[model samples]
Target chain A: MFLPVSASLRQFARAVTADRLAGDELAGAITAENIRAGKPPAAAKADLFREFILKWREILDANSRPRPFSSAEYVRSLGPPPSEARLVLLLNDICGLSQRDIEYVLDPLSKPFAELLKEGRAVIARQREERKALIVEDEPLIAADLKDVLENMGVTVVGLARTADQGAREALKSAPDIVLADYNLDGQKTGVDAVIAFQDSHQCPVIFITGYPDDVLKGEDVEPDFVIVKPYRPEAVQAAVAHCLDTERFFAIDADSANGDL
Target chain B: MSNEKSSAPEKRVEKLQIMVADSELAMIDDWRFENRAASRSAAIRSLIYLGLELTKSDPDAAAKLLDQLDRA
Candidate 1:
């Protein structure tokens, strides 16, 4: 996603510390080359382009975009050039950092965000457990992980289905709290189809996660709480699940409460 | 401004840091690539906004709204 500020704020940053900006030639090179390549180029934010600022910009860009991992591994093969700026915000702009980037930065096993997600779940869980929770996954291991994670957070995994048919059957039976469906399943039917099928039986949120992002993830019928990418840190997964569950609670509380359970 | 920065409530919702994944997030170089269409994050954000909008006037009627949207 593009930032709120100037798109080419790269050069001004490096010039601040390096005591020298890349000069006109280098500035043109960076911006011109990027533009030539169909990528966004650096632009100064008005007078913010003091010499030092330009230096820092380059450095910031380097640190922020730190050469994107070259593949789907999402694992950074090299460390970034050292700098003392708040980098996470910049990392947010990093397009190809592996699924592990956030996890690596914040240990899901022990980070504050992890704790927050857990706490977040409890907040909603303590409320009424009105909706049935559904888990649709073909991978037994990941399914077990979700079940464990949800159960640990005190949100029931009402039912588990390995295929669209099985998930749809469960949906018909329980009408689920939310469906945590893997985007691509083992059978011919996809998570989108599963969501449509399940919704046909009942209305519930679907939270999907995938390793690859493509057209398959679309469809107006599915209002997923979070579409986590695959290789997501445990904390990220927990956070997404927590959100959909919470949405259900909020949805239930609407004054006219649909099921009259609100 | 300081207090605004300090006391300004974090946008974080409990348990869920965010509802959706990036609509465009997928594997680019190695990081998640966010697609142009409905990434999970994008969907979540939209859903949250939609949820807030719907619940404001008629929460119980949300199902009907969703139903309407589904039909629309």
Candidate 2:
């Protein structure tokens, strides 16, 4: 109920601000402030809650300790700053904020807030799906082609890692969603080795595109998530990535569908 | 059902203990959070699975890989 939410919010407010306002005192102050601002109680509460979360996140980020996966923390972890409407959905969905509590806190805006949640979800989903990829291909022409292909698929090419070591460095720095690596890189360390090195700390899906299948097969490092034979169609690259992200059962189904169409 | 009979199958696994620097540990923790995995173990397992799945071309690829790894 609102009791838990109110208590938690007050506790967080005290922790962050180091101000101790009694429970009713804080609520009364917030209500008075909302009235002065010419905003409805519900909307004001929602806004206040969002602001509190943002402030708390900043405080948490400044500290050395690991952040908790609480409501606000989870929202902050979603890569980019979420929209107000999206925050509402996260509060409702992830935080288990009930309609009554939302009404009490967010007020009359509760119904409309719920309505706007779907649109916000689509926006956030699109942003989340804007998968960033690091291309570790040595060939300039091939790297450009890969970048174009990935961009066309709505993936952002963070950078092209020409050598295995550079690829590892870029991947560590950017923390890309996926890696597109060529088996034979420019340096002594193969693309497979580079991806393995990246995986030692950061875990991102990788798709290996290479002409020398045996080179990868013979490698001692861990294997990539998916391998596409060279001279591949652009569509094949898209399908391979989709397959990895899709449900495990759906992957075979998707492959079957692709084959059926062919 | 009795506790033993109803219990999950015992997984035969080797514990991999590695010494990582503070920075490296932070990186792993960050990766785990970003991936939305339940735990560090789950994150590592998912990563290994993804790698294995990508490299595997056939059903018996795992056995072949083990053989190759052993020989190497």
Sliding window of 10 residues with minimal summed lDDT for model 2 chain A: A246-255
lDDT value, residue B71 of candidate 2: 100
TM-score for candidate 2, residues paired by index: 0.37
CA deviation > 4 Å runs, candidate 1: A1-131, A215-223, A248-255, A258-262, B1-72
Model 2 is docked with a DockQ of 0.01
lDDT of 2 by residue, A80-141 (tens): 23234544543454334555555444443534765656654443333324567899999999
Query: What lDDT does model 2 reach?
Result: 0.54
What lDDT tens digits, residue by residue, belong to model 1 across residues B6-64? 33222211222423235423332122122221123333444455677778878779878
Report residue A73 deviation for candidate 1 (angstroms).
43
The list of candidate 2 runs beyond 4 A from truth reads: A1-129, A217-221, A247-262, B1-72
TM-score of chain A, predicted model 1, versus the true chain A, to 2 decimals: 0.50
Alpha-carbon TM-score of each model against the true structure: 0.42, 0.37
Window of ten residues with lowest summed lDDT in model 1 chain A: A70-79
